[model samples]
Target: MAPKFFATRAHLLVCQGQSCQGRGSALLYKALWNHLERQSLAYYKKGGSLRLTESGCLGACSYGPTLCVYRPKPAGGGLEEAWYAAVDFPLATRIAGAAHEETPLPEEHRYGPE
Candidate 1:
């Protein structure tokens, strides 16, 4: 059978690889969850659902505690992903707010396209 997938407007992929974990990815992940829950945008829910995933090694070990945000194409094409580096709790909260509000990410936090 084919794999099942859930539709969402945005997806946040937090790197939890060894390097990132050592650099505090776990705390970042927890902060993100708290922010999302406060915003009422839990993963795989109904309306305003934003998918949150823990990713392995995004290949920017030097920039540990990295996160990638993916927004689905409105015109039915491929997804758009952006990378953010050296993220902390505050930045994670802002990222969650951006995804919740359907707004662009803050310039400082974003690294570039991933």
Candidate 2:
């Protein structure tokens, strides 16, 4: 049997594909890490955890430096996903802050299909 896993309220996936990396995803990722760390949400072992991951292409190469946030459903169902594009350090910091506070993503930054 597969190992059981604990559920987190939020997950943030930053795209590190060639295009995104070229467009400064690394800087965005670093900014995100710093923000989460400051908010005490950097690691699962720490209090107020948030799962952060670096992913492959999210199929939005034209919108390099893309990111996706997964928020768990309140009714014990699957997660709700949101995609953001053209992320920079400041926007990345805001995203991290949103995850820390369990708030919705910034509307202006959202991209991809509905």
Candidate 3:
């Protein structure tokens, strides 16, 4: 059977591979969940639109504590995807807020599409 999907505005997939975890991605993931809890957007079943998930490697192990965001594009134009690297706690909070508000991700400490 196919897995069911939720209608989430976006999902924050934090890298939890060996490299990212070594760089404290686990803490970053926890921090994001905390922020999501505060905003009441942590669970899709609870009528929330934001989701926090863990991923493996993401093929950018050099950039530990990395994360990716996937959301729908405008005009039903498929999906928009972006991967970010070198994410720390302070920046993680900013990202959480931006994702929750459907705003642009921060420009600093984020280098991707390579």
What is the C-alpha local distance difference test score of each model? Answer: 0.81, 0.81, 0.80
What does candidate 1 score on TM?
Answer: 0.82
* Runs of candidate 2 exceeding 4 Å displacement: 1-7
Predicted model with the maximum TM-score: 2
The estimated TM-scores of all candidates read 0.82, 0.83, 0.82
The best candidate by lDDT is 1
Cα error, residue 15 of model 1, in Å, equals: 0.5
lDDT of 1: 0.81
Ranking by TM-score: 2, 1, 3
lDDT of 2: 0.81
Local accuracy of candidate 2 as per-residue lDDT tens digits, 23-114:
99987887887777777787544676677899999999988799998887667687778899888877777776777677876777687447
lDDT of 3 by residue, 2-37 (tens): 878777787789999999999899989988888778
Q: What is the Å distance of residue 65 in model 1 from its true position?
A: 0.5
Q: After superposing candidate 3, which stretches have Cα over 4 Å from the reference? A: 1-5, 45-47
lDDT of 2 at 26: 84
* Candidate 3 displacement at residue 92 in angstroms: 2.2
CA RMSD (A), model 3: 2.5
